[model samples]
Target chain A: MSIQIIKQGMADSIQDNGRYGYQHLGINPNGVMDPIAATAANLLVGNDLNDAVLEMHFPASVILFKQQSLIAICGADLLAMINDVFVPVNTPIIIEKNCVLHFKKPLSGARTYLAVKGGFDLQPWLGSYSTNTKAVAGGFEGRNLKKHDEIRFRAAVQKYDAVLNGKDCEILQWKASVKNFYAAGNILRITTGSEYDWLNEDAKKLLLSSSFTISNQSDRMGYRMKGDNLAIENKQQLISTAVTKGTLQLLPDGQFIILMADHQTTGGYPKIAHVISADIPTLAQLNAGEKIQFNIIGQQEAEGILFDQQQQLQQLQNACSFPLLKFKQQYAIN
Target chain B: MKSPLPYHILPLGDHALTIELGNSIDASVNQNCIAVFHQLKQAGLAFVKDIIPAYASVTVVYDVTAIRKEKPSAYLFMKEKLEILLAGMDLDQPVSHRKIEIPVCYDLSLGIDLQEMSQEKNMSIEEIIQMHTNKSYRVFMIGFLPGFAYMGSVDEKIITARRIQPRTNVAAGSVGIAGEQTGIYPLDSPGGWNIIGQTPLKLFDAKRENPVLLEAGDMVSFTAIDINEFHIIKGSI
Candidate 1:
């Protein structure tokens, strides 16, 4: 019925899809950095796409389950373990009571998502369970999960036991396909923003060809990138306007910043490009000091990729039902 | 008489569209922006998620998933619908304004940067206070942080630039002026504005139905008060 955090990991917090409609009030739509991975984890646990999940960065937490429950780990390959046994990612597993789950070492990606069956029993703020730490609102006390924090599950013990079928632990045969969601290598697909033409020819060329290193100053708000100085031809002051997640802004000093999940509602910098929604998860998984390149894609192509991804998610939702049906057939009484 | 406002509807991305009303801060332009924002919300577009109005633009964030269900292309559908709405829209419609009065204490202790600002501006403390409280300011936008309303074109005589070294944490409700803008800090955060006074009002309360006291289209006027009155208001809250 509940899980207790033995050791809080680095920047772990409960997040749903996001808190929408409040950007006008300067409220950021703080949520899971990688929505694709979060959705995949939820699907594995028989939860809705927008269900709240635990989003953890590297060097994540250790938890002890107080009751039997079904769970799924997705996103980064964090090398999670149950007691001494290794647990795999992208697959659903049933944990017995008193079992300890711990994550160790740096995996391939930066973030890991954990989804429990029936989602977390938490109140939503402004129609979302996403935590906005700056505002001190939403999620679990509006902050990152700390050691000794107890999270209660909405699922009943009897329901999870039915899925477990008297087994102490069980790993489902099926796994979520995540390879297609991420881009190959470090190239992030992007589309030209409204101010794309404001850059000089040399700066525009450098933007497309040069490789940029993610600076240590990067955070949930934005990724400060270090590369060639991209100068604008006009150097005119752009009026402050609405800036969304993935908007690539050019600072006055000619540096670049990619806005993220917790980006401000509006910004004054010139927006040169925007990372496609389909490729945001790939960008989110990249760690600081990691080198990445921008590959400009047409608007039509970006839209096509997004549509395909949504279709794949729909397929995943449909595919997950088979396992639920099998569990019911084997465990439910006639 | 005011001329008709010219606007451009540009795509922020696949999911969001921004209507650029003008490039500068003007009352008429902002009023038109607010009017259009209200109309769009009243239109009740099924795919629209969030509508954010700023100094010179109104960004409409829509749900691509919902938009795609009805049309073959999400962006095209949004663009077309928005364009149609804009074509038939009235840009001169008057928007209702809410005038809010905030009480501020300009005590020497509370105004952390008052001495520095007074020396820089070569003005007396009473003159500085008079200039700040005389004029009513317009809320251009609420940004930088939640409930932090960016308001005004402050009087030129009292206008000043941001501090070279920002304070590590400016106490919440501290009224500060930077450049032509003046705002009250809704939270204790790092800021560089020239602090002139402090208010007792809780500008932001998440528990309240409307978390932010001021929004993009409100009018704000400050009333100078003494330290004793500040304490009295603080205790009541």
Candidate 2:
């Protein structure tokens, strides 16, 4: 069965973990901006961690389900409604056939992920379903979802029915909480980069103490920040080098830019710092005009936080899968 | 053969590592960077996901989940493994090279910044075209966009800085030069380089087995052509 798009909102595309092994050719690893939420949604639907999901930005789309399916909506509280009835986030639910799903007013985060059972039956480009819009490749026709675009699912009626328990709409009891991954006061933890020594002492002080406002010019490529100017000790040009997602670059004008999922493979600006992996999801959810402070942490500390986050995700995966295994054992007819 | 060059391995967060070869952008240093990239890929490390080679460094991105499963720490495992690999590394080893000829049409209508560049350099348009086509430049890196190969060390006379006001849209296959580097735009995007000509060939086709026309460590030379020839080549493709 398939879902038909009635109205496409701001920007929505199919994404998985990310596209890899092509960075040397200048290809960006475009993928879901928030991995934790996306993975949580996938786990709720009994799909693999890297299974493709619909990453919808605020003011997202309206879809009509052609057949009954099990689904989960994670991340941003977009006020999702199924046939005029409100639904909750971070939980699995079943949608009856011919029911319309739409989003209302903007709520908390900037992105929301919708995962279906068995994942989407979309073709994978470069070994990934993640869309790279810049290259006009990958995902569904290499672009944002447009009105009337139909997406087919790898439907498993028996599996979804067992999860649904023959109900038209059912919400699971257990929900995956993303609160532990986010930092208090919107402070992002970062580690000094290779060129961190280039900044003067005063500049370093300003960077840590001052709060930076995210400019409207920010996008999936980078988040342009406005704050006190950071001065470098030397005026020499940095030889262009390899850069990756989360690299905080200092522009010529003394402004800051945090590279995001769709960032270029290499850059010429001096990388002053890099945000830790654990807090990347929080940063991804932050909207423009939001203020963020940087907290400098040692590399070892950053690694420790990342390890803990991964371990928590593994525990959640195990928790979600156990119930599904029991449901399958009871429902399957020999 | 020259002795092995000194390098510093720096961490680029928990999952990636940057190998800085040197401060300058020399051909030899870039070759060494490429050599290390090949060696690392040949190692077939289960943790390593991608390797990017630039002007003077190679950034290796790894899967932390996979690495952490085998070792207590992913970063430490990468550092130790790389140290052992580099201990026996030979920087002077001979490697194969590929030379590619790109056909360009330098018609004044197609070259938006040709006249400005000519005036700034105090050279005639024909002379500028001749200088651009004479040298076989080396590909230092491929970045900024997909299939955009950064070829370098353009003739000193023709070298010019980027435009103060970048154009809103630079068409795909447009050849441009900025500072000591020359490159062709694989996609239409905002750019500030001095556009001198356009190529009919598709520099990047995602449908192809190899999407990029050029890669790091390759040699590229331009062949000037007339508008009619450009149209002929464009139609044939």
- Against the native complex, each candidate's DockQ, computed on alpha carbons, is 0.79, 0.80
Cα lDDT tens digits, model 2, B32-141, are 98888888888887778899999999988988766776777788888888888877787787888799999999999888899999898789999999999998999999
Residue pairs in candidate 1 whose N, alpha carbon or C atoms collide under 3 angstroms? none
- Candidate 1 lDDT at B172 equals 95
Tens-digit per-residue lDDT, A1-334, candidate 2: 7888899978899999899999999998989999999999999878899999999987899999888777899988999998878889988777888888889977888899999888888888889999989888888899999899998987655334655565556675667776787778889999999888999999999989999999999988999999999999978988888888899999988998999989999999989999998889999899999999999998777877888888999999898877766655765711
Residue A191's lDDT within candidate 2 is: 93
Q: For model 2, what is the error of residue B46's alpha carbon versus the real structure, in angstroms, after optimal superposition?
A: 2.4
Q: After best superposition, candidate 2 residue A57: deviation in angstroms?
A: 1.1
The predictions' CA RMSDs to the true structure, in order, are 1.8, 1.8
lDDT by residue (A17-67, candidate 1, tens digit) is: 899989989998989999999999999888889999999987898999998
- After superposing candidate 1 on the true structure, give the runs of residues whose Cα lies further than 4 Å from its correct spot: A159-168, B1-5
The residue pairs in collision within model 2 are none
lDDT tens digits by residue: candidate 1, B47-77: 7889999988899998787667677877788
Q: A21 in model 1: Cα distance from truth in Å?
A: 0.7
